[model samples]
Every structure is written in structure tokens, then in C-alpha cells.
Target: MCSLLRSARALATTVSLAFIFNASSVLADVPQAYALTDIGSLGGYSVPHSIDESGRITGYSYTAGGIRAFSWTQSGGMINLGSLGNDKSMAYDSNEAGTVVGTSIVNGQYRGFIWNAASGMSAVPCPPAATCSARGINSQGVVTGYTQIPGGPYRPFRWSGGELLEYLPTLGGSQGYGAGINADGMVTGVSYTADPLPHAFVSNADTQLTDLGSIDGTTSYGKAINSQGHAVGYGADLGNKSAFFWSPELGMVPLGTLGGPNSYAKGINSADIVVGQSQTRTRATGFVWSAATGMLDLNEMLLGDTGYFITAALDINDAGQITAFGKDSYGRIRTLQLTPVY
Candidate 1:
């Protein structure tokens, strides 16, 4: 089970004026700077997972009873997407239509669920006695995640409004995990290959999985995919990990660390701007990366002194809005939203 615990802006323009002036491509839709806003929690603490182009954020927050899935908007604040007769629910992704997907406990079993303003919360179809999770949903409302029967390996699955679409093809291995879906119906995730090593994979229009090799390591994971089919994730070798960006033309390229041995890329927008966490010489910090700027410490791009030390960026929308998690001055984890300034 993925624990909720596991998962920037700007005076940024003035400092990166050189890179902005020398911009080589429009793919560098880099923000000049960002204004940060603390997205208040439900009660105890909140962890956000995905942000959509409309700036809608979905994730889980602690409540008086237990963890509950929620979606936050600028106008609506935090809207609880209650679970399916249980106290535990986690929302991992949302689409342009405001459809959210994640896992919920139903009758003591973890089952995938989909929620929208129209339908509210509904269970995603899965095989009998199978545990399922809905990790990502696309603009078209296609859902991607994983399912597993008792004593069997996890199998990546795709679903739509009503039924399970199909089990995604694997790289000849027994286990697979699907994380994100793009508007084109492409799914990005990790699969165990015949060699039994975990490898990142992306599905094509034909629904076939293609392995995206590692960043000089034996393991790779495709965490999220954009509408353009580009994917972002991390690769691991032994104990060291490196974040990477993958495109059909460029392949997988490691986004260098902030100055330390480990970095993890978790989110990317259509503009190719990447966001994640990297280890700095002194501490772990959030980062935003692109071909034009390489990588910039997100903490250094703040417009003013925020009492938060950003540690990981979870998602970025095409509008350049970012949802991230960090520690406040009191060392409590907090969820934040960053909006780009012109």
C-alpha cells in the first residue's frame, strides 16, 4: 500500500534572468516567480496528490474519524469526497472534468473508486475478491491503476466510466503498477520484465506497453504522463535514485540533483516543466527543471519568506499551478499551492 506520507516559486525570474533571456524553446514555459498559498487541511493534516489545469487539487486529509479523500478549489476550498461506507479513502488524481480517482476501504477491502460532482463516489469495477486502486484519471475520464487477487501478483488495469477496460500488458513480468493516464489514453507506470527487474512503461494507442529504460540503473518507474505522452519518474540503482524525464524524441534523461546523491521527479506539465524533490548539500528541497534552466531549487524562487521548507512537488498543471508538500516552521508537514506570476 502506498502510504500518504511518501510524497515552488519565485523571486525566481530575477535570479534566472540569464536563462529566461537565453531561452532556446517555448517548451520552457517557466514561471518568472510564484506566489505560495497554504491550502488548509481538513482538520489534522492534508497531503495533496494531483492538480488539474483548472487548479483543482485532490488527495487525502485527516479528519476526526480517519483519512478521507478531498478536492480543493480556489472558490470551494476543501470539499470532502467521502468514502464508500468506510473511514479511509485516498484520492490520487483528478481530471479536467473534476473526476477524481483513488482507493477506498469498503467492507475492510481496499477498492478503487471514482468521484465526480454528478455521481459522487462510486466503486471501480474489479475482479471478484481483488484489491484495486485508482491512481490516475485522464481528461477523458479514463482511469489507470492496479488490481490484485489474493496470492497473485499485482496487475495494471485501465477503466472508464462503467467497467474495467482491460489489463495493461506488462513487460513479460508478473507484477505491474499503472500510475497515470494521458488524454490520448496512454498509461504510464512500472512493470516487472522477464528479467524480473522493475522498469518504467508507457502504453501506446494500441494499449501495448513500451519499456522506458532506466537512468543508468536496473529499476525505473513512470509516475505521471502528460497529454503529449511524455512521462516523468525516477530510477534507482542499489540505494541511489535519480529523477528522469522521458520523451519519444529525447528518451530518458536524468534531471541532475540539487547537489546531492538523490532526486525524484514526480510531476511534469505540458510545457515540459518538471517538478520534484532533490537532495541539496544541506537538506532535501523541492526543484523545478527544464531544458532551459536544467534544475532550480524551488525554495530559492519564493516571492517572500514563507515559513515552509518545500520538500517535494507532487503535481503541476498546464496553467503552471503546482501542488506540493513541505514542512512548516514547526516541522509539521503541510500542503501548499503555488501559482505562477507573469
Candidate 2:
């Protein structure tokens, strides 16, 4: 009887060890996510805005004298793309083919530009007396953004192969802004309608606009749209803001905050992983959310000082990498990237 009891105990111990080993192996096989790497500046500070599938990063950097657009390569260092004759420029989005779309101050006014390694930067024509800014560019080089008309409201526009077209008509209000564009040329934005309230909207390729109503007791804005037509943004509910993921199938599903009163979903990748920022009881922090993991604070994942505040997660890629900006201990703003831990 004693021998049998000992044998049973040994078997149980072996099984437990095997289970732990398998679990560890599985985690190891998955890429340990959450690596933060600083994309160095051009003799100044760098703020990464977007990353393509090829790992190319585009953003703006402050040089000794002014801000300039930049593209960072995984192999090479930061390459500066000078402005269109002004002292400041910003790169908003880059396509897979390495083409960058952004806005530059030209002749004392804002103008959209498309930049490439071969041709440098060229102005994208906009309606007369309108200030244009490009927000997103897809693989096909189609750029989507909004144009501010002189003495009037802003209107969304789309540019492809050097031809710019006015997007859907505005919501009978004075301001409209396009935030993101997907591969299919679908655009999402926020506009003020007849009710004098801001509402989220989606525009189809053919220029049909559909209003994506806000959450109950809240105002909403759509930030980013994925290829699957999944849109993520934030809505203020009962004086508190919360992130939300929307689709035709599931409608709007609220992604609760990180134990705080406010959260915003800024980017959504093809895998449905969402990246954004959330405020906790003490400080703000970057977060990644998915169906499996819900919401996770990137600062917690790094085991860093949680007292610091993360302001916003600007973008995320399909590889689960994130780019954001936050305030450090000394009150200086810093750009950071977080790679998943598998």
C-alpha cells in the first residue's frame, strides 16, 4: 500500500511538470511580443506615425532648426524628407511601396504631398483656396484626407495617381475631417450634422456616406478602419469616454477602459488587434486589446514605472507593433514603440 501511494504521487508530479513544460514551450514558440525600440531622430526628436508591412516607419522629427518628415528603415537609419519650402512638415502615413503621404506648408499654406524615393516630394492638387492634409494611404497609393476651404467648412478628398476628387458631401455642417482610409478606399471620419452634433461616418468607394451613430448617451468619433471594414474609435458615455469596435455584424461593442474614465482606440490591424491609450486611476498608459486578451497595459508589460503617463497610441501594425507618444518623468514628450511578447 505504501509503494502504491508513492507511485501515484510520482505520476502526478511528472504530469504537472510536463504540462508546465509544454505551456512554456508554446509561449516560447510564439514570438515574445512587447519590444520597445526608439526610432532615432534626425539630430532631434522623432515621432513615428505609421508602419507598413515591410517594417518601414514614417513620421516627423525635429531637427536643429525645424520639423521635417522622416522615414526610418529597419536596416538603414532615419532619412529626412525635407519640407515643400517651409520650416515644418509631417508625414502622416506610408504605403507598402514606400510612398509617403503628408502635409507641408507651401507658400504660407498647408498642402498635401506625396513623397517617393525616386521623385522626392510633389504637391497634390486640391480645390482652389483649400488647405489639404493627407491622413492615410493604402498600398495602391490612394490617399484620403480633408481639405479646408477658405471661409467655409472642411471637405474630405481622395487622391490617386495625381488626380484628386472630392469625397462625399458634408453632413450639412461647417467642419468634416477624415481620419483613416482602408485598402478598399473606404474612409471614416467625423462630421457635424444638422442636429448640431458631431457624428462618425463611413464613406464608400463610390462616395456614398453612411452615418455610424454614436453610443447611448455619448458622442462618437471613428478613428481607424481595417480591411475587414472593422472600425475602432471612442465615444463619450455618461461623461466618461470608452473605446469601441464597430462592424456591420457586431455593431458597436464597447471596449471598457483600463480601470479609468477614458480610453480611445486609435488603430486596428488586420488581425483585429486594437491599440490605443487608456487612463488608469493614477496615470495614462498605452494599451493593446483583442478578443483573447481584452486590454493590456504596455507599461505593465514592460515592467516600467507606471507613474509616467502615456498620452496616445497613434498607430499599430499587423505584426502587433505599436507607436505612441507619452510624457516622461521630466515632463518631456517621448515617442515609443511596443512590440508584442507573443
Candidate 3:
């Protein structure tokens, strides 16, 4: 753990810090009010992986038949995205237009698929004979993910058009996965390196790799990047993992855990606000972080009492809305969205 200090006090201690804030000021640093609207599931878990600028959400859920993809909106509610003639399908990310990209099994081969309300789901474009998965899509409809072509290791690629598949270079490693893409076409993800560590890289163009090394650790996985080129992810430090924020201006800065041994930054917005999971003394908890306020437990930021215990915060939008999963009043996991209220 790092020994960095905040507020003139050491921050790297193993003690849980969720209780560190003074009782009176605990909710003062965050919005005074928050509202929750549970995104109902298909009789089972409704996992949300990403949120678009327009507040559309996409991910996977379990119905009576089997697992299926779903898209959610404030007006329309949850709608199941049928499978690709298989029992498995997932919706990882969506673009501004509510188009989703994720993996599906076709003829027993894993394939990438993109879906929109207008056209439904279709196999995505790829190099000949290559197996692929789409992890992210930008507002302009650009897609980024990994491809496993025969005779070649898995490599990240960007697709602007059907035949315009551009492979990105790795950090001299065997595989790379594209995790996030911003409007400028900058892709951020993990690139396994010759040093045997998963180094994060960001590139606007497909030919070059600008690897973001670990923050005093051997592993750096950049999970999300924003329009400002700010990135957030996690890295290992002294047997403990911690979330991190990255940029040309700040480089890599660790966001200490919630008083536990591990933390992961899963989403970042244009304002540089971050959301993810962190280890508390008892279990993993959702967290929101900002440079000005440091890290705070999401549950603590709630405006009123509730039975839910947020476990993982998967994504956040510039509107200050957060997508997450947690135990509901009945102790069952459920997908939830948090909107800030003035």
C-alpha cells in the first residue's frame, strides 16, 4: 500500500476509512440529494456494464428461458434483447444512439454483435476467419475490441466501417483488449507486455501504443477513458490492488481503497469523476471519487435511509448519474441507477 497523505494525514493504512469522515460532514461533500430507480430484471440478475450519454443502459440479464441481453431507458423500461440462436449473450457497452456491442455464441463460435432498436442484433464486422468481441462503442458509432484471427494472438482493433478494421499494436505482448473509447477515438485498455505485466495503453491512432505503466506496481489495467483523455482503472501495489486515475497532466495517481486491500475504477466521465468497487472491511462496496473530495462510499452519499447495499458501481455519466448493482430489500442482487438531485 502507498503511504501518500491526504488532508495532512497518512492514507495508506489498512484500516477501513468509510467511517473516517466526521459524522456531520459525511454527506456534505457530495450532493445533498440522490434518487434511485431500480432497473427491474428479467426475473433474475440484470447486470449493467455501461451507460451512454443519453442515459440508455445495456448489459445482460436472466429470463425464464436463459441468459439474454437487455437495454433500459427511462421511458420504455427494460426490454430483452433476444439471443443469437444460443443460450448465451451479453451487452457490454452502448453508443449514444442506444446501439449495443457485446459477445454472442453463434454456431458454437464466440462472435461480436451490435444491436439497435431499429435493426436488432447483427454480427459485427471483422477480418476473415477471426473471432471477435466488441467491448465498447463511441458516439460516432466507432467500435473497439479484440480479435482472435488464426495464426495470430488476440489483438485490439477499431472498426469505423464494415471493411475498415484497424488492428492496434500491443506492448510487445501476446494479447490486448480494448476497454473504452472516447469521442476523439482514443482507445484505452490493457496490453500484456514482455515484462509479463498487463500495462494499460491509450492511442488515438491505430499504429502506435502509448503504454501507461503501473502506479508503483507491475499491473495497470485502464478500464475507461473520457473525452478529456483522462483514464481510470486499477493496479497492484504490495499485494493489494487500488484504483487509479491517469492523464498527461497528472500521470497515474492511485485512489486508495475503502479501507480494504483492493479497489477497481470502472468508469470515468468528462468531469473526471470516477466510480467503481472497493474493498471494505467486510465486503466489496461501491465508491465515487473526485480529485477534490477524494474517495467516498456511495452508500454514505445516499440522501435517505434504504435497505440496499451497493456492491459494484459499473458506470457513470457526465450528468452525474451512476449505474450499479447491489443487494435489495429482499437481499437479492438488483440493478440500480442513482441520479443526483440538487
Candidate 4:
């Protein structure tokens, strides 16, 4: 009787230990990426729109009454990049050299501005009677965006220092918007042609534009491009939008949602990691997608107010860091940063 009791006790102990070991191994396999921190506001609301390789961040913040552009450093605090003239300004994108570019409301009209440590904020000169906006700037100081031509349509423009050159014309529809540009001067955005369909397009350095048709049964829009000419954006899937990653080799590959039907791939880093937002069963959440890990929600990977609705990931860097915006329970906009736990 004593020997049987001892054997039963030992078997139970071994089973318990084996269970713990297996549980620990399963937990270890879970991805380690998570939200680093919330880039809090400057007395009001803040949203981080872009991050560079060095972990420098840029975006817009609303103060007591007006909006102001801001840049955040890894070690330094958030620094205000003041406006061109009026009370409203925004930093949409930044380059590796800390050069920031975006639009500013000056004298009651919108004008593009670029800022650097040396030059401060200066208006991107537009043609007489044209309103220009700079959307993206590459490391070489080349800016690409759009300008409204007098009595004509909005056309894409590229600025190298002081010279502003108009690139390929719009796809015959009335309007278009330039969203992103790469180091190679390749531009991507949405263009409306004769079919009245707003399709995504990629323009080469020589102004040759090619329309990257939507995933079957969807209308598409291009958001960002990386150095290797890969584009990331969203496309409607029979009325539901899903994030997409595109390259010359594979055309448009859908980055499916995180257990939901809607997803938007807002940014792509050089490593091909895509970041965006998706809809779960309960609410909207931000997600990072890679070939290795299918999709992960920012809220699940981070400890925070899980009730917040992550709206969009504006940009990501080579280090796998992401900058994004969302709405809190109070319906106010909030910015968040996610860092990879490698």
C-alpha cells in the first residue's frame, strides 16, 4: 500500500511539471512586439504621423486653441516646429536628416512648408496663383506632393531644393492626390481616370505613370512607398476594405485583417513590415503585419486602455518602430508608438 501511494504521488508531480513546461513554451512562442509608450499631448491632443530610422518622430499637436507642428527625439523632449504664419500647422512626414515637411495655414490659405534645424520653416514656393502642399520628403531633400494649378486640376509636383517640376498628369479624371514618394523619386497615390474609378498608381523618375489595378472586385488607393519601390495601401473587398502590399513582382498582395474583414495598410518599412488598423469583433485596433507573424493588434501586445480605437498607423521605420493615431474612450485623438521586442 505504501509503495502504490508513492508511485501515484510521483506520477502526479511529473504531470504537473510537464504541464508547466509546456505552458511556458507556448507563452514564449507568442510574439513580443508591443506598444512602447503613448507620446502624450502638449496641453491638448497629439498624433504622431511619421518616424525615421533614428527613432525621431514628427506630427501635429493641438494646444489651448490652435494646432502646432512638433518633433520628438529619442532622448530629447518634444520640440515645437512653429508655423509658417497662421495658428495652424502640421508635420506630415520627415526624412532621415530630420527635415520635416507638411502643410500650414498661412494668411487664411494652405501652403506647403519644410523645416530643418538650420533653415527653420520656409514656404515651398508655388507657381503664381497656385496652392502647394508637400506630402513626403526623401533623404535627399527632394519633396513630392501636389499643387493646384490655376483654372486647372491638382497635379503632382516634385521639388529638388528650389526648383518645382510637375510630373505626370492626372489620369484624365478631374482630381488626384499624391500620398508618398521614395528615395528613388518614385511616387504613389490615387488617380481617377475615365472610368470614374479612383485607382492607385506609381510614377517613375521619368514621369512614366502605371496604374496598379485594384485587387479583383475592389477600388484601391496607394498610401506609401519604400526604397525598393514596394507600395502599401488599402483596397475594398466587395465593400469591405483590406490592407494591401504591392511590388512590381507580385502586383497587389492582400494583407488580410486580424480576424475581421476591414484592414488598412497605411505604412511599410524597408524590411517589408506593414502597419495599419483593423476591425476586431468588438472595436477597431492597430495592427502590424509581417510575413513571419501574420497580424498582431497593438492593444493585445501592450498594456493600456483596451477600449481605445486605434485608427491608423501613419508610418514605420527600419527598426520596426511604428507611429500611429487612434481615438480614446473620450473620443479624443491620441498618438502611440510601438517598438519591436527582439
Candidate 5:
């Protein structure tokens, strides 16, 4: 994500965001089955990285000096979660009660931060001069992500209560990241397994980390986990990456791509519905999958003139709204929300 923001900041510009789902394209005045609304940027580019059940979004917006983290809501719109006296910050996840978490650049290094409406944005402490970021927060206010010491690989961490950063156990190697956390205080992320390969992991309330074996039994990285302990992610297998749905009952269920050999499962809702990106031989495609529906291309389901060629789905809410990154009618990348009308 840091790498992506760096590229977006370099290509930042004012893009006129406008498109029409007219009758000439698909249906007449039947109303859009899914409305794709642009979440405008603060300056350069705005990407909605994660969305909570309440439809609150948190991501980064590139500015003139640098990028800034932002929190957006239907009623409140976009609010810039300012940096820690620096020019860059990127938001990753928000939980119930409107608390946002991410990383902020402070004194030339990246550090974690928790943003709230009343208290504003404040730094969550770690080792001095370390690159750290918070990825997800649960309703219990526990923030999870990774922290890196100088010249060291990232180590997954948990911040709870006041100023205590707890490092979770690694599977074997020194690198790890906590990408998503559930209401049960379970965290899902990637950790190097015994083979020194990235594999999905889950942390219990006791901070005991469990390795959820990869599809290839060699490489995997977890993305999201629902309240029911079902985790979703991607794993390299047969020289190709594939999206997966993992649970205690079924283990890892592969979600094949749309005629391509690559797919990723980014976020999962309480209903076990998963959404993410997939390869289509030529370009990336957004996908939504479930036990009942399997894996289906989002663009195919979004009939009419939605004007969105979604390439990735970052998050999905319980109400079936998907926050995706895609190109507009003119091929400009935009953050859009697809709310099912039916």
C-alpha cells in the first residue's frame, strides 16, 4: 500500500469525475440497479482502502506536499485525518464508532496513528524511528498492523488500551503483517511459515498465532476475516495466485479466476461473501464470490451503464455495498461504491 501511494502521488492530478448511465447504454429510466458514486479526492488521488459495516471509508488522498489519510462517510463526507506534523499519512481501516487507523509520517519515518472526530489524529507509539502502520481495528478498539525496526523486516503488532504495542508471534521468519481483525479479536495476516514463505495466520485473544496453511502449502497471505472466524486471502499455487476462503470446517477453498490463473480475496462480510481482484488474461477484474454463487465477475453483475470497469474490490459491507478501485468511462482510476438496489 505504501508503494501504491508513492506511485499515485507522483501521478497526482485534477481529474474531472463524471459519467452517465443513460438509456442509450443499457436500460432506460429503470433506475440504476447499482449506483457508482465517485468519492472525490482531497487533492490528487483518493482511494477507499477499507469500508466498515456502516459504510465508512478510510484511505489516502494525495496532496501537493504529500498524501493525507482520510475518513469518509455518507452523512459526513470526507474528513482529512491529518498527518503527525508531516506531509504524508495513509488510512487503512475503520471500525464501529468511527475510529480510523493507519500510518503517519513523523520526523521522516512512518508511525502508526488512530484518528477520531473529537481527539483528532494521534500517534500510536512504537520503537523510535521505525516504519509502522495500523491495518485494522475491531469494535473493541484493538489496532493491528506491522512495525519495522531499522534494517529489519516488518513484525506484526497489536495496540490496545494505552500505549502498549504487543508484537505477535511469527510463524518462523522475521516478516509479518496484520491485515484484518474480527470482533472476536482474531487477526488475519501473512507470516513466513517454517518454509520461510509467506503464509496466512490468525491470532487468538491470547496472542497465540495459528498458521492457516496455504493453498500451495508453501505461499499465502491473508487479507480479511469475518466475525465468524472465516478468513480470506490469496495463495501462490501451480505458479499462479488464487483467491481462497478458509475456515475450520472447509479449510482453504480455492476461488478460480475468470479464465485467468490469478485472483485475490480482499474482504469478507458476515454473510461469507468475498470480494477482490482477479486476472482476465489482459487486465485485472473485480470479483465477488460466495459458497452459493461461487466466483462471479462484478462487471457482469452490474448491468446497465454503470460506467465502471472495476479492477479491484477493496472492501465490502454487510449491506452488500462494495468499495472498489476501477477506471471510469475515460479510463481514469476512481474510488467508487456499488450499492445493490435490489
Candidate 6:
């Protein structure tokens, strides 16, 4: 009887130890935390829009002259991307080749521009009297954006080879926007249907647009696209906005907020890691989302007391490097880069 009792106890102890080991292994597989680096401004304040694979960042920063586009690197610091003329320029996206695309006020008119080290800022030719802006660019230098025709609706367009302009098809309404492009030349943006409601959409390589329906039937905007053709953005239902991830397999899935009703996903990477801002109980907070983790507050992942909380995560690279905007205790905004610390 004593021997049987001992055997039973031994078996129970072994099972408990095995369970503990498996649980610890699962925890070890979780994502790594991040360390913050404050990339200072050009002058007053700065807002980062995109971060490329090589850690190059492009955005608009306030200079004494005005708001000017800038490209920043770890070694070179911030270099102002001169305007098309003598006005303001705001860079929206940059490709791996260091090509920057954005809109600049040229000769008192808004014109889309493509800039590279070889060629200085050059305006993307548009129809006469039309105001255009380049919002996103891919690895192949394909640019996507919108052109507003005077007395007409905004038309989404794709520019290639610095010359040809391909107008994308609208759902049914007149106004549409091209916000992002992937390495495969797929574009994602917002389009209004016959219902006159804005719906997120993704375009195939053939430029055929597929409407990604909204979460609650109100409005949706596709902000960025990933290598897998997945898109991330925000969808609103009766004015309540929620961050969403749309895939070819799954339609629009809401990424719930951190105890609030509003969230906006702005950037996604090849790994399908999504970063954005969410409204927490107190204020707007930056967040990172993955398949394993639904949403993790970036503030909770800070390695040390960075003295500022991230307000919005604008872009994340394949290396898990995130470019974001942070607000200090005094409400001053600054651009920051958060690198994954394993």
C-alpha cells in the first residue's frame, strides 16, 4: 500500500513539473520589449511619417522658414529636403532606395514631388489646375496618391517611371484616395461606393480595386499595406472609430482599443506586425499588435523611464523598429524611434 501511494505521488509531481516547463516556454516566445531613441526635430517640432528598411526616416518638420520635408539617419542626423520652390514640403513616404515622395507648395500651387539624391525635387506632372499629393511609394518607385481637379472630385492615381499617371477606378462615387502601396505594386486606399459611404479598398497588380467593407457600415480608410497584401487602417461605425486589419483571408477585423472606443492603425510591416494609436482610459496611446498578442500598449513595453509616452506609432520596419511620436509631460511632441530589445 505504501509503495502504491509513493508511485501515485511521484506521477503527480512529474505532471506538474511538465506543465510548468511548457508554460514557461510559451512565455519565452512572446515578443521582445523596445528601447526608445528620441530623434530630435528640425526646429520646433517634428512628425515622422515613414521608416524604411535601412532605418531611414522621412517626414515633415517645422523649420524657421516653414514646414519642410526631412530625411534623417542615425549618423547624418536630419537633412532638410528642399522644397520644389521656396514654399513648404511634407514628405509622406520613402522607399529603400532613399527616394522620397510628398507634396510641396510650388509657385503657390500644390504639386506632388519625387526626390532622390541623383535628381533633386521634381514635380509629378498633373492635369492643368489640379492639385496633387504623393502619399505612398513602394520599393520599385511606384507612387500612389490623389489629385484634386478643380470643380471635380479627388481622383486616386498611380505614377510610375516619373512620367506615366494611371488613374485608379472608383467604386461608384467620385472621390477616392490612394494611400499606400506594397512591394508587389498593390495599392490600398479609400473609395466611396454608390451608398456614398467611404470603404477601404485594395488594388491588385492589374489595378482592379476590391472594396474591404467596413466594420459597422459607416466609413473605413486603408492607411497602409504589407508585403502579404494585408492592409491596416481604421473603420468607424456611427462615429465610433476602431483600428482594423484586413486580409485576403479575413475581411475587416477590428483591433479593439485599450479600454476605449477609438483606435487607428497607421502602419504595417512584412511580418504583419501592426502599429498604431489607441484611446486608452486616460489619453491616446501607441500600441503594437500581432497575431499572438491582440494589442500591447507600447508604454508598457518601454525598457526605462523615457520621460515621454508614445502618442502614435506611425511606422514599423521588418526589424521591429518603430517610428512614433511621443509627448512629454508638458505636451511637447517629438519624433522617436523604438527598436526591439531582445
Most TM-score-accurate candidate: 1
User: In model 4, what lDDT does residue 292 have?
Assistant: 51
> Which should have the higher lDDT, number 1 or number 4?
1
Instruction: List residue ranges in candidate 3 displaced over 4 A.
Output: 1-30, 127-129
lDDT of 6: 0.85
Q: For candidate 2, lDDT tens digit of each residue in 1-342?
A: 433333353245335434643554521121344666666688866777787766778889889868899887778778898988755889988878889989888777898888999999887777757898888898888888888878877887777775656666666666778888899988888877777777777788878777777766447888888887778888865566778777775566677666667788888887667788887777787887765446677666653443445577778877767777776667766666666675
Q: Compare candidates 1 and 5 on TM-score and give the better one.
A: 1
Give candidate 2's whole-model lDDT. Answer: 0.75
The segments of candidate 6 whose C-alpha lies over 4 angstroms from its true place after superposition are: 1-30
Which residue runs does candidate 5 get wrong by more than 4 Å? 1-33
Q: All candidates' lDDT scores?
A: 0.84, 0.75, 0.81, 0.77, 0.80, 0.85
Q: Which model scores highest in lDDT?
A: 6
> How close to the true structure is residue 90 of candidate 6, measured as C-alpha lDDT?
96
lDDT of 1 by residue, 270-302 (tens): 877889999876888888887667788888887
Residue 260, model 3: Cα distance from true site in angstroms: 0.5
Q: Write the per-residue lDDT of candidate 4 for residues 254-305, one digit (tens) a residue.
A: 6666655577888888767778888776677888766555567876676445
Model 5, span 193-237: residue lDDT tens: 766888898888868888888776679899999987889999976
TM-score of each: 0.91, 0.84, 0.90, 0.84, 0.87, 0.89
lDDT of 3 at 305: 82
Model 4 lDDT vs. the true structure? 0.77
RMSD to the native, candidate 4?
11.4
Name the weakest run of 10 consecutive residues (lDDT summed) in model 3. Answer: 6-15
